[model samples]
Target: MKKTMFAVLAGMLAMGAAQAQTLSTNAADTAPHFYMGTGIGVVKDSVSGDRDRTWKIFGGYEFDQNWGLEAGYSHLGKTGFYVPGTTDYTAAHIKSSSVYAAAKYKYALSERTSVYGKLGLSHGEYRYSSSAPGWNFKESNNGVYAAVGVDAKLTERVSLYAEYERNGKRAWNGPENRIFGAGVKFGF
Candidate 1:
């Protein structure tokens, strides 16, 4: 977690320093400006395919052609983990949530459409303890995500898009969350 934040901050500082020398309000610097957006979303846990909704928020600076930084939180719900033997172990109604920080690079396909790739650290959350009956596990773990999606500029300062995200489980989670969501971002 600390390393991820450090990277983000360092990257942002580098970008800022670089831009300071070339940025201009005129056509010479007609490059893209920084913008931020946030919205709500839903996450579907692999276990039982249950869905937990959450407030999704992300913000970063968009520059030149297509480059930016974003981070957000995703609230997830309980998922069932069914073990085959040992009295058919069941990982209770465990509540889960995720927090992620990513850096994205976009490729513009048109004036309003673009595709992006993002990589970063994923933090997962759960409520559990050894003494708890029918449930014993780590409360959190670091994960990874690979997503592909399209973004459309809704207005000069706003945009909308949907992304399909997949994550891998570090331990046991049937599978990570398979999520699809649409959100709108308004630039400031």
Candidate 2:
């Protein structure tokens, strides 16, 4: 009986030591790091039912477990409008892009997952050009930008994220561009 009890206690101690080693080796650090990612999404104009492809490339520094800052540029895509009564021919095209920065706040949901929100200011330039000669227009707007997203860690220095972001209006009372996208981030 004494030998049996000693064996059982020894086994339990060994198992506990192994478990602790596993967790320590796999745990993510809260140290600051830099990361970058690119994503593609659709920019939809609600009234026009126009779905256009938009893409962005962004990079940032994560300060700790819950805060970061990032800046990015987006190619907001182009939308071609037909003449008022005709769908067979194109009349004008509007293209836009933006540059912005934001502060990110993250909340960890688990060892490998988190949700984050960002609020920022954006400046966008929109250009309208007509098929007809000498009919071109340009405008720009500065407004509020916001986003919410979930991130899942894939490895020690990699993650995948899906987000819904609003790029705000192109002008006062102009159409707002909303985007839904997913992408991967690499940390360094």
Candidate 3:
């Protein structure tokens, strides 16, 4: 009876060890090492209350499941306006773009879903131009940026996410910009 009991206990231990190993391997397989994504949204200008189409592309490297670093470029779109005292004849536009880097933190809600946030710095360029002479201007600004989003995995290497971001001020004396967008991430 003692030998039979010992044999059963040993078998249980072996099975538990095997299951643990399998779980570990599965976790490693799902952890993203590198990823890239692209998204499109509308940028709301805080100064003018205008909405314009915006788009971004980004790549990231995960240090582990919960922490990573990301970098991206965004075209924040163009806004057109009428030159003062010449509303019918003179039109000018402002175009904005930025490059940014951020540290990301993610929290898992399930095996297939997570929520994440990013905080970083961005360098922005804004160009104001018109057919009318003396209306051309260029400026650059640097400021902090932030974003929050949810990610849902469709497969081991592919996922989708929706995000809201503040792209920062266009210039020292210009407007703040915000975006809401969704995109797909490909992991490698």
| lDDT winner | 3
Lowest lDDT block of 10, candidate 1: 21-30
Error of 3 at 188 (Å): 0.7
RMSD of each: 11.0, 13.1, 14.2
Shift of residue 118 alpha carbon in model 2, Å = 0.5
Query: Per-prediction count of colliding residue pairs?
Result: 0, 0, 0
Off by over 4 Å in 1: 1-34, 40-42, 50-55, 80-91, 129-138, 168-175
CA lDDT scores, all candidates in order: 0.59, 0.73, 0.75
Tell me the TM-score of each prediction against the true structure: 0.66, 0.77, 0.79
Give candidate 3 misplaced runs (Cα > 4 Å).
1-25, 29-32, 46-48, 85-89, 171-176
Candidate 3 colliding pairs: none
Local accuracy of candidate 2 as per-residue lDDT tens digits, 32-106: 989999987667754376666788999999998899998888888876655455455757777788888999999
- Residue-level lDDT of model 3, residues 77-128, one tens digit each, is 8776677766567987888898899999998655566779999998899898
Model 2 TM-score?
Answer: 0.77
TM-score of 3: 0.79
Q: What stretches of model 2 exceed 4 Å from their correct place?
A: 1-28, 83-90, 171-175
**Candidate 2: global Cα-lDDT?**
0.73
Model 1, position 186, has a per-residue lDDT of: 74
